[model samples]
Target: MTVLNGKGVLDGIAIGKIVFYQRKGQEAVKRHVENTEEELRRYQDAKEQEAADLKKLYEKALHEAGEKSAKIFEIHQMILEDIDFCDAITDTIKSERVNAEYAVKKACDTYIQTISAIDDPYLKERAADIRDISQKLIGILTNSESDTFTSEEPVIIAADDLTPSETVQLDKSKILAFITINGSVNSHTAILARSMNIPAVVAVGEELGLKYNGNNAIVDGASGRIYIAPDAETVRLFSERREAKKAEQEQLHSLKGKKSVTMDGKEINIYANIGRPEDVEAVLRNDAEGIGLFRSEFLYLGRETYPTEEEQFQAYRSVAENMQGKQVIIRTLDIGADKQADYFEMPKEANPAMGCRAIRICLTRQDIFKTQLRALYRASAFGNIAIMFPMIISVGEVRAIKQIIHAVQLELSGEGAAYNPETKLGIMVETPAAALISDELAKEVDFFSIGTNDLTQYTLAIDRQNPSLEHFYDAHHKAVLTLIRITAENAHKNGIFVGICGELGADLSLTETFLRMGIDELSVSAPCVLPLRKKVMETRMDR
Candidate 1:
């Protein structure tokens, strides 16, 4: 029996046969083609086929995964349609008199190497997207099947790493779990696995030999361990634990309609953080009271142009109407740092996290900000909707945002567009400066939603994205807790409600502390709502 340790990104248990997944290597043949015109024709045909395949994948992903995730396929489609990329391939084939496959391989390798050499980690990661699209095109040109998982029985897929496009194409029914030799906990693969409710363990060292392929394996995602050919006793124990987990999930589901009230009758609002309107279905399934953080930046991603006001309005309105009057807090564009869009043409910053991002971008680029505000206002008339600004640090920023809201409201009134005049306005208290002066900032906004993810990173002076610095990135540090306490106290004193809408809010261990801090609400991912509700119901502040 072999026991391999890894970092588990999702919590679940699965026992299945191992299916080693290795992407077919693209060997560039440098043979000269006699007919360059025919080679170009071949390349164009393969490109068209790749586009059609991506379109089908996009539609399928839209139905199965949601629009936000489906955008990955859209990004792939855009890559295929990139004029520069296509031109480069055509020029290489014509000028070099090379076969279509060889020309494409050279062009893709150049771009991939250039992107991988970038200093910014986010941009460097984009190389994977390029690789995925290149693989598809090359596979079509070579008349070979692209990388895929096909099995009649359930299996645990083992891979080096999965691109976002590859991850979405997986057949979930046949995939019992995923074990990757290398991956990040914050990668799209991990996020998608969690959303699909699939068990996944990543960063497991590559020493687990390929000889063990097709071996029986048990993946304990909660413990970040994979057991291969386990002893009979170990299998029995794991089977019992799996049963217990199933029962626990059933119990949590049974609490769907129950209010999140503590034993002392302290009612806490349990909300969900959503990336797009399609996530509202998960929010409803988990029985969240409302949406605390609607990451409104998703509409701007994976596109060459900014989304129109009408498009944004339709997206926001769908969530509001679907929620049926439940409070939907839509955060304005929080791009510029880890999240970016090429069309924005943002200037590179030495340190983007603290640079011109979030509220700064909105304040400086009021045109973009106003467009989103107009959409949110237009959607407010459909159902309950509130606007929340992100990365706010001072009272001045809050006032500036309100001024923009006022202008948007005036514009809507002039156009005779119906909107809720009483839509609630709020700001995310993420930085230490914001938390320290929460009392002053609280007076300007209707509510305070503490973004602990950034607050903790800023407080600890750690880049949470860096895996090497992860040990220094303590979310429950004394300073972070004190900041939360201070922000909660100040917000309550100013007669405003405060809530946590970060990863820390979903920590069941911290539930008691938050309840004692008088946090009015706790918002997390959809899957966490029921678990948090269960914790809230079991908590006793009096004790």
Candidate 2:
């Protein structure tokens, strides 16, 4: 029997378990992970074989149909090959002699502990991804069973949290809605659901709280709402609405292959904000104008030490090559609050966010910074490359950083390094002081990117993590908006471009506001590219 709780906007509903993650037997955990990993490799081999066979079938189908070529699968596979890490994780689990669940939990805890020691807020967010992946590998080893879907019935699965891997485990045709007692909006579980286009609700209190064996519910993922055992008419309405939304999404898909310009001819740059190099494909699919906010922290996080220059160069070069001649803005290594770069020998600061981060860290750690700069410059020879400095608050600091950039340029030039000298230099206006002094700083930097997230938090003196103060940290607040306006004004006055590389840039509701402020670019997540592009194409700037 399940004890269900009907929280506001969420109706407690009964759910049945279709699949489950378990704590594999201690000794068997190692064997289980090994077997699963081997199974995956075998599956890959099988896929390769099947794909070859299917290729002939696909060619036949296309030739017979005499229609435009239809892809059986994506052109380039964005293989998230964390196999080495996974193997290492399995080894650690076996050596630690911990239970499967505990080993998985420990890996997540270790990642948290490591990342919690960094000062860069951006890198810190990645810890969430780490935890999500940890949960995934654990589930893979323990939850040998998988969820299956048939038209017969829609089942509800209960879990502490749904990971990207766990979500992928569900039978797409049969799995209806999943409820998790854990996981927040920031968790990758939610992101996975969004990508999979499934209806899921997280933080549903508890598994037992759901009515067991006798109840049904619907999950409204878009609004993060849930419907309990509704009457027939209500269910019908929801079903109809879902179908309508699906149709609408299909319509939205038509906007692809179109330019992201407003009706009134206001050109808003719809760029992709990517993390992994593999995510670059989404940019091309979404027809993103360029890459904005390319988080380089991924190259360092979860590593024993910093990536060598060649390692960094290859990673950077991948984006430049994939972009195929589009602009790509790469921010220097931003490892601080919530980000622990293990091999960097960085001491844990009392307040990492305000401590050594972004340009500050680059200044203090010249060896790492120059390597990155060298990589960036070298990659610049490949395409349109722009380097952005984060958390810069002073004109003096920007000038000092410029000197360092020049120094690197000189050294690389002397070494006959293959690089670009014309790479643009930009600064992130995250600190209030930076925004306030933008008029003066704009003259020094080539461009200005307002990092509205931090700027909002700092300008209002609010800790964003604290729910109580969230109301005060509104990016649209008059003060924050004024600052953005002032900063953009300053940049325009100095004949420098201004763009926003924050969540505000992607907020469709705030697109008008950004356009009103004369923002030059709007960088957003890859998945959001099309909708944002469509939004921009629909909107008109009243300039």
Candidate 3:
């Protein structure tokens, strides 16, 4: 048997033995280098030994996957100090005198063909991070210490894509699942294979390469398929459908401390949506209940500048003291559209998702929105810190974000510091003019998340990164669920509270139509909080 399929971001099941991964290094000849300053000091000692091997793969992806997979090795050490990728490999090693591994393979094939001709699928997956830092700087100017892939058993792998330092230098218990042939389920190797729950599948094409190496595949990942050399009655029908998806994820860990409530009871918070502060240990191992979208632009993507207010108050006081008191919110700097950040020199925008993004660059840069509202009010004295704002569309930009958060709470109460003057403030009813004035922007913010992926890419004017408008991209379009039921009925007719962080808040078929649209919260992605709290405890709003 053979099968194939593709796009299943993550699930579970991997019968393995495929392999393709090879990174060693070999082709970079173009000689004639009569010492162009010893090939620019051997290309600055192979870019300082690939920036000390990307700072030990960013501290082994911040201790085995966190801080959004260790911010892809801090954006590959800021694309190895990109001055147009080190002036196209120091002008091709001093204008073609060549040899610094053939001017880093002709400046990484003209910087991965100018970022794969950017029509921005997030800068075409950053051309797999300039082919993973030009194959580890031409395997460190050709000494080539073969970087990863040596499995004796647990296989699968396949590649053509996978770069967050080759998926954090493999050996994830020999990796029994991986497939690529091109990527992007927002790749950093699909966010470290959904934070290492493993079982992946991505754009599977190039007929899954290396001519099926060790053969015997399987994969499945809850049916994105894969198979390859199958039979034996298709491996006993996918080994009893991978033991019923490993006993339905061991019964979603017994609904993780329960209560997302619903049968006829209602109660729903279920939050969890982060991007840094070490994703609060997968939002406290998926129990969630808080952090409804901290994405404070990962302290301004891959830095070069701007992450200062004491480095955004020690990363919002380390996720509000590790969410001990829960509720985190955050969201302020949702950088320009498609999340660009060339030191925010932002300009060329023929529709950067309706340009000047997220609270229009924090209301035309109120000195970078009062230095991130004085680091989220001095990390709101370390707990329950709330503050949102992202691509909002006025009650005058939520009264100009409460006058720059009341002038950053009077300069953190006149520098006497320690804050939290009743923090809470929100926005991001993601744009149908803030969901048709969610009742006057829900009486100026105390809640409302609903960023349904840019409110279904600005209510189906569609271009959710156009893979030919994925069949008119509908995140269940009844006009994007009537603008998330008119911003959850004008946020409960103004008593505020409303949620849905986006990606249609982890669409388990729109989780019982966003709990019949009174949707007090959803927040997703911490492996979709126990499958959206087991689809809100097997729904039944009175059947």
Candidate 1 residues lying further than 4 Å off, grouped into runs, are 1-9, 22-27, 33-134, 140-143, 159-163, 180-191, 202-215, 223-225, 229-233
| Candidate 2: tens digits of C-alpha lDDT, residues 29-102 | 33334444454454344334433433443333223221111121111011112454445445554665444555
**Which is superior by TM-score, 1 or 3?**
1
lDDT over C-alpha atoms for residue 306 of model 3: 77
Error of 3 at 278 (Å): 22
Ranking by TM-score: 1, 2, 3
| CA RMSD per model (angstroms) | 4.1, 10.3, 18.2
* Candidate 1 lDDT over residue span 255-351, tens digit each: 9899999999999999999886878998999999999999987788765799999999999999999999899999999988777687998997999
Mind giving the per-residue lDDT tens digits that candidate 3 earns over 435-506? 887888788778888887777777777877555457667678788788789888888987888888877788
Regions of candidate 2 where Cα sits further than 4 Å from its true position? 1-155, 159-175, 181-197, 202-217, 222-236
Leading candidate by TM-score: 1
Q: Rank the candidates by lDDT, best first.
A: 1, 3, 2
Q: What's the distance in Å from true for residue 47, model 3?
A: 9.3
lDDT of each: 0.87, 0.67, 0.81
